[model samples]
Each structure stands twice: as structure tokens, then as C-alpha cells.
Target: MVGVGYTLMCEQTGPKELVEQAVRAEQAGFDYLVISDHYYPWLDAQGHSPYAWSVLGAVAHATSRIKLMTYITCPIRRYHPAVVAQKAATIGVLSDGRFTLSLGAGENLNEHVVGAWPHVHQRHEMLEEALQIIRPLLDGDNLSYSGNHFEVPEAYLWDRPETPVPIAVAASGPHSVALVTEYADALVCDNPDAAVVRMYDEAGGTGKPRYGQAAICYGPDEDACRKTVHDQWRWAALNWTVKAELPGPESFVSASDHIRPEDIAQLVPCGPDLEAHVSAFQKYVDAGFTDVAFVQVGVEGQPMFLDWAQDELLPRLREL
Candidate 1:
């Protein structure tokens, strides 16, 4: 069965709104929640980036049934893997084991604020080491490791969950896919690529949950939907390599300057057509994704979108 989840774009909304949305999503029949962890919004127009962990704490109390996870968190920089393990453990306990920790190599937009960003291979190496440190700690074991990129000095998680919080690694390439297969409990990607699933399975990730994301704009006016998507989500069209390297929101704005409304409309399902929205999600399902998260593009249309999803889109997807 396809697990239809909602994407809480912390970059696009404040903490209070995020918690509120989580409650609404659960009520609307979304099976789980996937939230983005970012220090900055992709564009100034997208608006806010509250600390995702704190917001998640609020979500845990406010909603009870829905499973929660970071769409992807970067533990190699800005945050040590130890701290991430601790946070995930505490949140898991607080949520009564309804949380998963989704990790990635991270992007320069968030990590570059601290210091010079490393090369792609170097970052992946760091991530591998981080997973090494994180996995044992989450299992309630004391860890000691000296790796090329990280050092864990006899670390232990005092507040770990009884069952370790599952780690879902986000991968967009062969190397990352292999890393996830080796280290992660689940595999995550944003696009509908069957080859990614095949690669993960071939690399020993068979039977693990495969998660993917779909971005859409739901509104009555097609023109307005196109404009909203262009203004807020043009960054969606950038390749992961470009996204991983760009320094800040300004760089993203410049990179997306040539992106037109039609360009965004073509990529993201826009307007209020039910079939268009259903088809957008179906692509990921067709690509063999077991879990799919939907990100609504504009704030103004969120309520309508959720209502429509509960009344129309979700039931249709469930039938598949």
C-alpha cells in the first residue's frame, strides 16, 4: 500500500503553522508527515525557517497518530551526528516511537554559513562516518570512533528509544544510494526515478521503505498557481548538484532568475484539476515508491488543498 504523507515545508511556514498543519494533515487522512530541515529558506519570498527539532517537539504533543520525520537533515555540518542522534532519540521518546530520522549529505545553503563547504565526495565520506557514529548511539550503545572526517569519543545516548529511531538516508546518485543501502533503514529521494529504486535494491536495500516527494500547487486560478509556484518553488527545478553547491538564497534567486512561471508549472502540478494532482503523485507510486510526501506550494491555498486531498485525491491514491 502507498503511504500518502504530507510535506511540512518548515522553510515556507513558521513553527506554529507547522504544528497546526500537522494536526490538520492527520485529520485529513494523510498517513504521515515529512518535514524539511533548513537553516534558511530557499528564497526570501518563501519566508521562514524555524528550528525543525523544536517545531517537531510541538508536533509530537499536538498530534498523536501521524508518523513524523525530517524530509532530510544534514548531520555532518552545522550539527554533529551525536547531537542529531540525541535529538532524534528524545523526539522518538516524546512521540512514543512515531518518529524517523531522515539524513542527507546536506546543502551549502544551510551548511556553508559555518565555514567552507567540502567537495561532494568529501561530504559523502563525512556522512558515512556520521552514520557509523549515529547508528550505534541510537541503538543505545556507547560509541568510540576515529574516522577520516569525524571523531566520536565514547559517546552514548542516555535517552534512546527502546527501538532505535530508524534512519532514512536521502540519495540522488549511485554513491549515495550505496551509502543508504549500507547504513540506512530506509531510502529517500525527491524524484520519480525507477533506476534509483533498482540501484538501492541491487545494493542490498531490498524490502526497505522507499520514500519520494511530489510538489504541487492547488488553486482555482491556473495563472495564480503558476505565479505562486514560480515565486516560491523555482528552486525545485535546480539539479541536486547546483542545489548542494549554491551558497545562499541570493544565489538561488539568481540561479532561478531565468525560470519562468510556465517552467515551474510544467514541473510542479498546478491548479485545481484533481487528475493533475493525482497524476503527479502517481508518478512516484509508479516508480515503486512505498511512501510519497506531498508539498503544497502556496500558503493561501493550503486549506483548500488539504480539504480537496481528503475528499478527493487521497481516496483515489489509496485505491491504487
Candidate 2:
């Protein structure tokens, strides 16, 4: 089945607004919610980066029925796998089994804040080790691990949900796709890349769910929408290779200095055209994604987009 979800971008809004948006998203007929976890917003202009786990806990208490997930959280560096597993379990229990934990190899922007930044290959290795620690802990098992990247001594989750929390691994390449196939319940991608899904299937992930996220700015004023995205999300158009190595938001700002509004408009669906939004989501479905989350770039456009989604885009997607 194809599922449509809403994205809660913590980088742009505070915890209170995020909780309110979650409630509105569910009421607007969204099937699930995907929240981004970050220590810093990509651009200083985006402003806020509330602790995603704390905000998610509040969202759990505030909303019922809608599934919640971290769009992607890095388990290494700033957070230990054991701690992440425990937090995920508690959130799962709080949300009544409507929670999923999405993992990524991580970028320097968030991980560097802790003063420990590994090489790209090393980061992937750390993620694999993290999964080794997280999976069993979420199963309510007490265990110790001695990996090159991390060590845990008889750590166990005391408040795990009756059912183990589901894990969705975010993958943009073949290596990560293979990694997720072995450890995750689902595969998540930011782009509508069919080859990533195909690689996951070839690596023994044929029946697992594939989740995708796409960003869009929906507003009546085209220039205003483009300007907002250009200012807040121009970093999105940067290559992952560059994004992975950037140390902080200031570096991102310097890197995104050349990105123009027209460039962003070309990449992201901007303005109030229903077809533009519909087509953007359709690309994910056509790419074999079972679930897709639309991230609204303009914070003020959220309610309007949700209304349009509930009344227009969702029904069109359902017909697909």
C-alpha cells in the first residue's frame, strides 16, 4: 500500500509548533509523520534545532493514530547507540507502537559538534557497529559489545515497548542499501532514486517497505516561496559528498552562497500549483517507494499545504 506522510522539520520550527503540526497533520489525513533530527539547522536563517527526541516525546503525548519517526538520526558521535535505542523504545511505548527509528551514517554538521569526526568510510563502519548495539538492546536484551568504534558494557533498555521498535535505515548508495538490508525493517531515501530501491531488493530486501522524503515550498506567491527555499534550503541542492564533509552551518552558508532562487525552483516544486506538488510526490511512488513524506520548506505555508494535501494532493495520490 502507498502511504503519504507529513514531515516535521525541527530545524525551522520550535517544539510547540512541531507538536501542533503533528496534530494538524493527523487531522488532515496524513498516514504518518517524519521528523528531522539535527543539532544545527543547515542555515542560520532556519534558526531552531530543538532536541528531536524530546520534541518527539511531546508529539507522542499530543497525537494519536499517526505513526512517528526520525527521518534519520545518526547513532554515532553525539549519541551512543545504547542511548538511542533506549530513547526509541520509550518513544515507541509512549506512541503506542506507532514509532519507527530511522538511522543514517551521519554528517559532520551534526556530529562535529562533539569534536569527533570520522572519515566517511569510518562513519559507515561506526553505523554498522551502532546497529549491532541498538538492535539487540531494543529486543530487551542485556548485552556487552566491544567494537572498534563503540563499546557497551552490560547495557540494557529497561523500558522497552512490548514490541520491538521498527528501524528504517536511510540509504543513498549501494553500501548503505546493503547495510540496511541486513539490519533495518525498512529503507529510507531522500531522493526518488529507483536504483537505490533496486539495490536494496537485490540485497534481500524485496518485501520490506521503502520510504522517501521530498521537499517543496507551497505558497501563492511564487517569488516569495522561491526566496524562502533559497534562503532556508539551498544547502539541499549541494552534493552529499560536500554536505558530509562540512563542519558546520557557517560552512554550509558559504558553500550555498552561489545557489540562486531559480536553481532552487528548478529542483523543488515551488508555488501553489497543485500539479507541481502532485508530480513531485508521484516520482517517489513511481520509483517503487511504498511511503513518501513531503517536507514543506516554508513554515507558514504548512497549514495551507496541509489543507491542500487533504483536499487535493492526497486524493490524487490515492488514485495512483
Candidate 3:
């Protein structure tokens, strides 16, 4: 089934408001709630970056049917593996096993607070180590293993789900996809290019579920949607310029607005029409993405975006 989702940015909205929004998304016909995790917002925006796990806890009680997830959280840097394991377990239990852990090596915006970004090779190595630590903890198995990057003492989690909440690694490039295919049960990516999405399927993944995501404004009018794009999603779009290469350990230096569009344009669909949105997402479907999560960010006119998404966009997906 094709499932619709929303991004919970820790911003102007509070826990109560977010729950309302989550419920609203459900009421609007979306099937999942994706709460984004960010330690800090873009410097200029000064928006609230709420602790996503806490919000998900509230959302758990608030929404009974919709699946919940982290749009993509960096397991290696922003939080420790133990913390990730515990939180994932808590959310899984809270949502009655409707939680999926979407992860990545991390980006400069979030990981820099911990230290210099690990080199690309090291980042993958770090993620692999993180998975090693997280899996057992989530399974309620005692763990005590030491790795080149991280170490965990004799620790175990008692409060875990009855079944493993499928873990999805958010990957873009071929290398990361291959790495995650070895460990992760699923793959989640914001990039919508058919070829890009196919890379994941072509890699080690055969029958695993895949999630494709994109930024959308969703309003009835074009101008309103554009405003949302500039306000929210642009934080990632502005400085996506990859003059050097895909970010890695040494390469992921601190950067903002400097991010170039060429890098992310293929990932974030532009335009105000519903057809464009469908076309962009269809690429992912054509590439074998069975699950698609659309973040209703970018472009204001809140009611317009949500209403159409439910009444129009969603119904069309039914046909697809």
C-alpha cells in the first residue's frame, strides 16, 4: 500500500500543537507521522527543534492508527546508541509497534556539535558499529561489545517491543545503500530521482521495503506553497551545493546557505502543481519504492495544503 506521511519539525509548534497536527494529518488521511530530529535549526530561522522522541511519545497516545518515525536521525553523533535503542523501544511500545527507526551517519548541521564529522569511510564504519550496538538492545538482549568507534558495557534493555520495529537506514549514494543493505531492514531517502532510487534496489536490497520522500507545499495556490518552501525546506536546499563531493568525515565541514541547489534539486521537487509532485514521487515508485512519505513543508496556507493532500493528492495515489 502507498502510505502518506508528514514531517514534525520542532518549530513554532509545541507538543500539544504537534499532537493536534499529527491527529490532523491522520484526519486528513495520511498514514504516518514523521517527527524530525534536529538539535538546532538554521541560524536565521530561530525555530524550535524539539526533542522528537518526546514528541513521538505524546503522539503515541494521541494517534492510534498512524505509523510513527524519525524522518531521519543521525545515530552516530547527535545521540548515543544506548539512547537511540532506549528511545526506539519506548516509541515502539508507545505506538504499539508502529515505529520505524530511520537513520543516517548524520549531517554537518547536526553532528558538528559532537565534533568534527567523521570521514565518509569512517562514518559508514561508525554507522555499522552503531547498528551492532542498537540491534541487541532493541531486541532486549544483553550487549557488551567494543568497537573502534564506540563501546558499550554489559547493558541490556528490558522495555522493548514484542516484535522488532523495522529499522530503516536513510541513504542516498550507492556506497551507503550497500552498507545499509547488509544490516538495515529498509531504506528511506528524500531523493526522488528514479535512477537514484534504483541504486538502492540494485545494491544488496532485493525484497526489503523502500521509502521515498520529498518536500511539498500542498496549497491550492502556487504563491502560498512557495512561501512554505522558502520558510521551512529551504534550510536544507540553500546550501546543498556539492562543489567538492558528497559529505563525509573530513569533507563535511560546517556549511550553511552555501549549500548549492544542484546537489539537492534532484531530491526536492519544485513547482506548485499536484501533477509535478506526483511525477517527482512516481520516479521513486518506478524505481521500486513501495512506501512514499511526503513532508508537507515549504509553502504556507496550511489548510489549503492539508485539505488538498487529503481530498486530491491522496485519492490520486489510490489510483497509482
lDDT string, candidate 2, 1-320, tens digits: 68899999999998899999999999988999999999999989999999999999999999989999998899999899999998999999999999999999888889888877998888989999999999999988888999998989789888877889999999988889888988889999989999999999899999899999888898889889999999999999999999988988899999999999999889898898988888999899899999999999968888888888888888888887
Off by over 4 Å in 3: 11-13, 196-199, 202-204, 238-272, 298-300
What is the Cα root-mean-square deviation between model 2 and the actual structure?
A: 1.0
Worst 10 residues of 1 by lDDT: 153-162
Report the CA-based lDDT of candidate 2 relative to the real structure: 0.91
| Whole-model lDDT per candidate | 0.91, 0.91, 0.71
Candidate 2 Cα misplacement greater than 4 A, ranges = none
How good is model 1 by TM-score?
A: 0.98
Query: Which RMSD values do the candidates have, in order?
Result: 0.9, 1.0, 4.0
lDDT of 1 by residue, 146-205 (tens): 999888777888886678899999987799898898888999988899999999989998
